[model samples]
Target chain A: MLSHQLMAGLGLSILWINALLIAGAALRELAALRARRARLAGPLLRGRVEQGLGPDRAFATHTVEQVGRAADVRSGIAIHFSDRAYRSTIHGGTLALADGSRHTVPPSDDARSEVWIAPTEADAPPGDAALERAWSEAKQSRGFARSLDRSIREQATIAVALPREEGEATWVFDERFARDWLARREGLAALFIVLELAALAGATAVCFVGGSFESVVTKVGGALCVAWFLGVQPIGVALSEACRPLHRAPVRGAWRRP
Target chain B: MSAGTATHNAESRIFKHPAEMRQFGLVLTYLALLFAMVFVPATRTLPCLALACALSFLNTVVIHNHLHQGMFRSHSLNLAWRCVLSFGALYPASANIPSHNLVHHHFEDEGQPDWAAPERVGFKWHLLNLLHFPNVAGPHTFNGVTRWAALYGREDFRRQYTREMVFAFGLTGALLLVDFWATLFFVLIPQLYGARCILRINLIQHDGCDTTSDYNHSRNFVGRLFNWVMCNNGYHTIHHNRAGLHWSDLAKEHEREVLPRIDPSLDEPSMALYLLRTFVLRFTRPVARAVALAEQRASVPASDLASRAERRQSIEAELRAAP
Candidate 1:
């Protein structure tokens, strides 16, 4: 049997190893965030519209409709729009327009489809300012900052100059962008998992050295930490993202044909 | 959806869901039991350890639910609730927000990127997976929380987290100072077990499933009693689909949105039965054969599953068709 002194030393060593791993993981994530910010440093919204031209170029004020169709519609469309984008859904079936008029329309069938809505009553787009702030803040911040940055980008309405040849180019916000963003975030997550593995290895090594498999605190703590890192953390992350409030900015100035 | 209008309509409401109150009650119950274990001499027996284990399990479940849907609309009240719950959890109340809520949820099981990806190590060796997970993922969870706190200007969150840390560690230190063995068996051991059980449930929920698939991505244990005790966590598909949904509303949502679209194999009537069959009885040829057969049946073509868009359409159609 391992002596108490030896056991204590091993346990302390394990804790120190874990502490180091945590520090290393945090630094790696910070580095990755820095790289990502640098990569996304250009214009908030860039790229010419390829096809799908419409003749209407004037900005019109239209009321949002269909507030109580289904949970999907309510959450996907109604709640997705930022406060600046549309009126409140408290009235259930009727949505108040930017013009103070209410309109009742069919339920939202597609989140991706363009619905006739008024531009937010802002003199200028906040894209550059929001992007600048997010970029600067991301350099110093960690954890959910990446997600917050993504959300900020998602919510910014930037007007892009369209080519004369291209009829209409709606700013490309699609599944591919979402998937790519998720993939990058996942890469950062991988670093954390590696750190966890290191901590576990330390604990396991100490357990073997101590020769006290029956130590309840050691056994249970090690097991709990391992189980939590492996599965529970992911589930929690997934659930939180699902429940996170949608704050999409209104899409304005798609550069339609006159 | 102007910020002012959305805030007025969505944020102004003080009470959103009924489950908040239920969760508060559970927290109170856990606190009472923890105090009893600490103070009452009669409650310090071996049997008390079992009771503590059970309470810790309930505490972790409540904490998990609370993390998803905060117990109170008031941030202060929620913070206080977290502090109180931390004693039972043996970790800070804010422990999961960044790691679990932000990172794990966003990534799911996308192999290496998913911090809690069970598939990182082979799922076939369940023992090894469980044994190694904390060491693997714990640091990430910690780092994620710390980074999030720094990045988001959540100074209050950081303070509370630190406070909870001091409270937990300080109390443990004090207990150890007073009586090491008692603290070990009564408090630390049970808390650890509770933590373990919490993680164990996740493995049971997501192991051996397509993380990307909408309906079949997660395996659900439909055991009524199990769900009732655990805040309906067994309905994982519904939980994943609508993460922000209150625990009380999961079953109804599952019936309406998930039931028709999800594969039947995804739902297991009893978690106990599944555990026994998969983990305990796998050595027996019959049980192994049955497990293999079930896995095969559950493996439906990806195309056969309805896209999220299709599901949304169906839900909209159902709602429109409804009176």
Candidate 2:
């Protein structure tokens, strides 16, 4: 019964480790994709902005118009900001709806911001209320966009925002900073592997020297393996006051001093 | 400013490569012995298995040393050592390496905990976890027959189901075909007691140690003879301080720095006795505050444990310094 139990546990440990290995593989894959996307798209966007096709203009001509046509909406513009230091992005453009009202609005700087166009009835009051609303909406959108843009440029912050509901925007902080901010995020799983092996080695020593069985259980039960990776492991990496760059960007030069 | 930078640079020489030949040989020999324990079968496979189990546990501790290569920076050798140690069947090397080297080393016990606590964990709730099934909130019951039957239900468990089933069946089948009493006494009962003992010792190590002093929280049973047999792991404080450092160098560095600092009076009691006493004392008066206060007095390496300086500062600041 006892050997059976221990054997059963050993088997379980194998499976658990394999699952963790897969999860680590996935994280590495995602990080690679993100890095690749950044590498490929970064230069092209920078080129366009430098050519005086300001992000807003370039997006209006290239990106947003295509999106508008694909979605069966009116014209749209994507405002691109050149500063990588700044994290905010703003989009401003006009939207034509099924209704005849041409809502010329500056949408928020956020990538997901949207401007909704509603039809004005022929029997509507002939005041400039529709135009005023459009202007007001544009003003609000621009303000938020500019603020986000400023925030991104000023700090090493990660965020995503999109317009949602009426007059409200949804913002998401990049909590996946652990994966992005650290150089060894992908290597975390590999580190865990080494730790487990060392722990097993240590347990054997304890057992050989003192006949300690608890060392075996603690080493093999997979709890310490779980705890180190989930709790202590990530904490050590995150809390360390070191910013290890994943790649050498000689072209980028030293980051501008704070 | 550039001169200041140069001066700072002079003080620290960053390594493009790191390696250690002596540590590598030690680790290689240790692993060879571990393999022998598993396959030699001198006393019987059961004793051999127990020996393997114990070695595998110790291997986990050594894994910490291997990652840092702090004591032995022979980059090529450590890399090879890492590869071999990680590939062991007893414990998957890849899983622990990344989790410990990258995640646990980075996270410790707080922040993003990918390795420590379970998604859900508790003794009362853990019976479900044993079968690899996480319990949702509901009334659940188990009787002797049902519990026994549940063991055979492999579908519910994603990872260990097939592996455990095969091992159990294979062991039982081999035993029934051979000497039943021998299997019962050697394989069944002794192994069970061994596992139970392992858990008790593990729990006692950190159970009532001063949380404030991270070093004290995880007590070290130090002795050259004992440590040498266990890959120099009795130097818990030094190991935690320089995790990537190898086991052999851990003792040397610990003696050079930590030993001279600790009051010799503290040498009278064995770590085992101290931990045991703390465990008993915890039952009557929880050691949390005292431990925390003690931690304020000094530095202890285990991040979960506290330091004496911090403990003492906090106490003096609170109790005496306030004029």
Candidate 3:
């Protein structure tokens, strides 16, 4: 029946769509974990730089990490610290502090990565809906490009230039935003776990269930399960990227001498 | 006239390039095979259905190319061909104009997001990105198409789009009425699969690429067989840089212009290797794309049918200008 076919497609779409959303949520969680990882850190225990900087170790270490994110540290991201905050430019062992003084930093990758937030005047992207009318009305009142250019150009101050996106990866703010962010993220983490469980359970059942399932359904479901398993292999890469190596952590790095 | 010259002349009259015959043939094969399954139930095997699904996916690609640069020289034939392509993919082919050609080609240029940007999914696993990308992208494309048509679309554009859409769905409806089982298995599955694959192409080609750079904006799959089967879509960096270039000329254009200027990492020897590395073995992670926060930040790309020589000169200028 057409109804049966449509129903099957609908069922498949609903299942797959939820699966995708869950995967997206996991990505966001890792981003949040990373952001949390970037916050204030303890002074390096007894490293050369830690010993050299003495009491200024923690502040310098934290600032350096944040500054790296703002510059060309990552493949594509460049999230410079806000104007008020101190930033640095790393040149191998030497660090050029934002304040103009330079310091020699260690070779280890142990600094915390600051989250990138859009500036005050940054307007969120236009919603994807009924664009024709919105465009027409806007065009009637003022040229679309001209209006947008005027609006953004009119801003009194711009903090970040072109940055990446929102959510865990970039959405910037201070520790005050951290509590609410944590609360919301805790719910998301819970959701992520639940979704993972459900996906595993569903895929397992779909793959292993016997003759009760229509043979065609069994074949299609099994294919989806296998394919999905293949898809998640990058989870390893994502995990490797997100999880800081315990051995190389700032505290551990700081404790050791070069 | 000699038979060879007569045939060549006739072919030229029908198609802008003789190569489009292959695309037209594949579209026919998909439709013919679907009907064969419907009428000749014995022919409806798993392999046959799978072939249908493959052809159906190819149909979407063919339609995408057709939408970009019409294969037929005759305007009427081009419009009629869209109906055939639409029926094969089970959606109006014109939708690609707004969703892919306008929005995607611009690639979040002018502060608008590519509706199908991989960041939309940002799946933990690479494979999941491909699998689930279509679910998000499909709706966005259609919605964008509808909204675009309502605002900027012309009378002919709206009429033609409506006609193509009605032909696709109307024919599918008629098929369902004739034999629901055949329509479901033989037609719908393949159509849906094709639609999904086409949607995945954006993420596959552009994901993790430096959309900001002059040369690194897209990943290119350079496998000869892959390009042959996919009508040279594997050379995506060149395609985006030169949207109006014919599919047949893409390989040569990519070699001469894109291969030199583009980051070597953007070029892949095999799409199969890419799919395995990206979606299966999961070697690469999504490169966090850096786009401007403020609206209207993007510089406009060149006008349509941009010369490859012009792009090369631009790349050279940027390189020379770079500190």
Candidate 4:
């Protein structure tokens, strides 16, 4: 009877270890997901680098079309910096046209009027010595390109370059806003890692704490569990990419500044 | 679409043409074989479990690689392998091949433009599971709701969702006739395990995602032990970087980095605690921050796809440029 109990306990331990193996698989899977996210850490739209020191030297715009949206604004145009980009309604800003005439339009009353924004600077292009160093450093960071891409694609176009001295007479949109956002996200990434690990641990603990065939099955059944947890998107992506090759976009390398 | 455009599109896209007859035949064979395997009496649960896990994982990896067109350039051959592996793996076939392969692939992490997300990011958001919620997020209702509505919808719902649900129902019916525990061990547990695995990884992949930047959204981890089990899935950045590269060649394509050893202590947190913490702290806060950051930096000049025509054009252009 004692031997039977011992045998049962040993079997359960093996089962629990198997569950941990599953959990470890989940952790391993996470590595791929992290990779996929890294792939998307930059601008999806391919645009040439507009050479310039600041907005005065280089900025271009495109007219917005008023079709199929809830927003009411009519006049919309895009702006470009070296790597950053934005689209804005021609509202309340001086449009220094190629013809040299400055036109100031009032902000639109339309609900759909979005002031598209990018990170193009007016005084110095990102390639300049001071900006170049910052770019290089930022590139080395895990998520610098992703931050820049988000800022470039979604936010309202800022007038100033990043890492500016406070005294500099530049109408700089706050680039740190995105960095702060990414910082919070980095914390989330860490949390996700922790959560995945815990799930594995929990499953293992449950098997150890509970001595039942169900526990054993759960543990043994869930081995390679960790990999499942981490690689869902890649699996989905692999599925999607495989099943529907027509839909995939070229995954761009995120611009790491360093 | 011009002749040049059609040719370019054909070259760039995964499903350049329709699936061939041999491929369909192979898929059918795989499906028949998988279902037949379930009905087979288990000689021993542990051995079968081991065998099934190994086989299923291998099939999943193979199918995945085939789907990416990373395996072969010949469309017919790619389709043949996809059918064989997916069916052999016992995954619901019709849904993933078409919906995932056709639609989601077409969209590729599109936020507002995706037909999947009618509202984009608004107050009504909750990543829905077949337009409803699952029990997994009971502890973190809102985040669970959002995660389900947002991520799940993107991950599984849109692809083989309807078909999978039906297939699961069919599986349940079939299991009723077979030994309940046998069904549990062989079918239910493995699939459930796989599902959980998918969700966890999916969340992490796009969770702290930067919507604007393409680079930071995904990063490759350099590890050999993990890669061996997952079939070079560790090189995901490179896989995405060159989706056409075969699974066998994935490791060779990317420059590897040194990764830290796995810490056993790190795996100590409970699921409930981890889920709750992620929901309360990670999900809402970091996403908000990323959005805010994008908005702040967006003040610079850039392009916006306001019209469907433009969006399609841009999408097509982006597809053309994709490696």
Candidate 5:
């Protein structure tokens, strides 16, 4: 009888594992879609940086975090700015994603104050392969010919509305910051994966042992609270890791001035 | 091209090409092995199980080629063939269309992350990259495939993909139900091995290569007999360059276009030798360079496995720097 039950559970594991694979897969696609749509949802505008706006200006502090140089994190010096919008959004440069919202440059000290406008991809939203391909090519070139910032700007997935002129300040990578941020992202992702596994196990066991309705509901519910408020930020990081173009994110070795 | 090989509209015999016959024979041998494992109890030894796994791994290679160019001319026959191939590797064979052809092959053009880029894994022991890769890649491929099928703007693709999922799982599940222990040990292990090995191929073929260069984009394993066993997968550069070209024709094309321009280091003589040297011996030039750069940073690679508690211990440093 024990053998029979064990065998039954083994069979069920196979079925459930495949079920998880597809479910995990579906979640990933939804996350990538959310990533693309998140920007269009108006920047999650938590902070604003501007030129010498007096104290009490709403700073988008939530959007910017100092991540130490983790394994994948590139080491570079970070410079802090005093302007309200002049965030140290990583000292290399700040990536602004205001589609068709005229990327304003911080007025140049010289007469040649030029700003680069990101091409409008909002109308189509790269829904097809051809457009996605074009966006990918654009990413490859951002570091070469175009003078764009690192991080999101390098991806060219979103336009860096106002480009910063080079030689602004000598930059050095804060490994501590990049590593700190990466560790949090990876740690949170692993935590979320553990939570999902717990939920999967609960769901499987409840079925196997023949659960009462109330007990089943409580077990599964308590096993997973993905939409709940228990751990929202880490969960977001984890899901983002699943879909974000992490492997392609190339960090420059140095942006220090000659 | 379809008329030349396809039997649906021709007076010719089925699968006249030598490569065509080889693929069909291999698939038949795999099915026979599956039968023997369950029925012939004496064949259930360690060597036989390993043989089954190797054969199952080869099944993935066969399906890769078979998916590219259908072995059978008739659509229904091809579908049946696909169901068998899918079960052999424990995945929906149709997934290659999305995970491989659409994404990995079109790496440069797609402008998205190749699901299995080697950089995704960073461990001191390079072998760990091969193991940890599937954890990151499997979800990306399956997830990307779901989106690709829907956004692909084709109803047939959705239908076919769904059918494959059902058939592959249904057959495997039935076998498990028949005898769980036997299937788990004899059959399922081989199936899982095939799936994992196939995923690792992405790491083996592309790691550390200049992905942007036309001819240098992919490393090739050009051993003649090795290519015969691998169905000419060794000639990889030209395969990526001209994806639609049949596997049989890759050798000649590699000789013409790739051999002249490809870096000699990129043209490895054997996949087995390359893997043993790169992952295990650690004497390869790349490994030497990494060791030289961080002779004392043994703790660095392992830091990739960081935890919240471990990080929180450093929170003071984190907070101090966060102005």
Candidate 6:
């Protein structure tokens, strides 16, 4: 036979568990957001590379050629850069450059190549522009690039030349970014873990006290409210994370400028 | 960007994908059914338990589609929707991310790595495989998720997964507080059945199929009505090929790319008929044998498959040439 006391105890235990779970999720999100903000604030290259013409076409062409060469040996390389898309087959590789050059690279393992574009060239303002104007343009470009298609946003890697002689940085828009971002925020993450654990303890104590109350409705209502508040936020984070791309593009070149 | 356009955009933004609107409708229907089961006196009978089980199974399918292509633009709203959906379905979206999206998609039909690998059981005993799959696969799925979280240092995923576990168990406990028998009948039994059904569908999808071939790796059920109810999931080959394609676009992709390249045996007209043939009737017919045999025959080197006359001539020449 089930007793009312037993039921109340079970409800209280659940309420405490739900609260702990929610608190942990909230803390993780807080840490993730902080890390993301820090990453964005730092001087990192972020923008879509427009198709270069005439003399300004070296980087895109070189990258496409290298990508084509790599795709010959390997399968599943679908790259969309500038104005054209290039899908590689085992038989041959087709590279469509932004400068309206379409060429095929023969399939060979020996043909593997890499192309590295200097951050200064990729991000530098064309012609003669004031430093302020270049900086403003760079900022706008970053914002615009964020709104690009998910495939481009996820697959593209930006070359960044850090200020104050900190040297060049490679910013990839994939899972590695998350790992690297989180690695830099170890202190905040530790604090969040401790706070979550404390919240769990506090919730357990509150639930235990509430279970002893005379009114069953009051106990049940309080548990439901706690569950609702705790459950909703973390579940949202999980959904967002699920929608994230699972695949990362193969990185070829990493040559950085001095 | 006009006032009318802005309003329309805002309204449209409620669901990110067109398929999400259908998902939203399914979720609403599940909620209605759940409320009826819980609150309506007429629905409190034993048969209502069966109804709950069916509804829960549908919820799992809906959640599976949501896990692949999220319902909303905002991450928070999608997560919230997942949590609400989980209450009905009893399968956590957090677990689904690592298990279904990452591991299963990555290492599909690859035996140990693929938690839902139908080939784990002996070829002669597919029914046993279907019956025992959830038991064998459930641990692997959870273990895979844990291993992935640890390997990638995905603390956020770990925390969210923990939260889902807590929420599921806590909600069950809370429900038990109201009525023990009702919770047992409606929630626990339905949850168990839903979980089994989820695993069963995966087994049915990939069972006895070639995992190596690009086009014919998975069997596709082409029933229009089933695809509609299952969010075009019947177009399995296309889904596997273009995992990122929206569920609404799967039929079009299937027709365009997969239909020509894929072997005829790989495409089934109805899942119900396939299941009946494969499991219920225990049909011994081999649909993929001809394709598999052809693939095997093609894989052999031309030198190995040379005619007897050529082999004899080569042997005689070799013997004469030998000192």
Error of 6 at A196 (Å): 38
Candidate 4's TM-score reads: 0.34
Error at B122, model 5, angstroms: 2.2
Worst 10 residues of 1 chain B by lDDT: B284-293
**Per-residue lDDT tens digits of candidate 5, residues A13-106?**
5445543543453344455445433333332211112221112321111111111111111232211111011123321223233342323223
- Give candidate 3's error at residue A9 in angstroms: 12
Per residue, candidate 6 scores C-alpha lDDT tens digits across A200-245 of: 5555455456555445544545454445434433443343233221
C-alpha lDDT (0 to 100) for residue B155 of candidate 1: 53
Backbone collision count in every prediction?
27, 118, 5, 99, 23, 2
Q: Write the per-residue lDDT of candidate 4 for residues B27-100, one digit (tens) a residue.
A: 34434433544676533245445455545544454455445443445645553444445334444332333222
Candidates in order have lDDT scores of 0.50, 0.35, 0.58, 0.36, 0.53, 0.52
| Alpha-carbon runs more than 4 Å astray in model 2 | A1-258, B1-42, B45-47, B70-80, B87-89, B102-114, B117-217, B255-286, B292-323
**Tens-digit lDDT track for model 5 on B3-68?**
655643343345535567777777788878887877676777667777888889889998888776
- Candidate 4's C-alpha runs over 4 A off are A1-258, B1-58, B70-110, B113-181, B209-211, B256-323
lDDT of 1: 0.50
Chain A only TM-scores, each candidate in turn: 0.27, 0.29, 0.31, 0.28, 0.27, 0.31
Candidate 6 CAPRI level: incorrect
Worst 10 residues of 6 chain A by lDDT: A141-150
In CAPRI terms, model 1 is classed as: incorrect
Which one wins by lDDT: 1 or 4? 1
Instruction: Compare candidates 2 and 3 on DockQ and give the better one.
Output: 3
lDDT of 2 by residue, A1-258 (tens): 234345435534543543443334334444554553343322211111111122524222111110000111123221111111212233433333234343332434433431111112322211365433432333231211112111112122222333334664323223244335433544553464455456544533432343333344533333333333234323322322122222111011111111
Using lDDT as the yardstick, the better of models 4 and 6 is 6
**Candidate 4 local lDDT, residue B183:** 48
Docking class of 3: incorrect
Q: Is the docking of candidate 4 incorrect, acceptable, medium or high quality?
A: incorrect
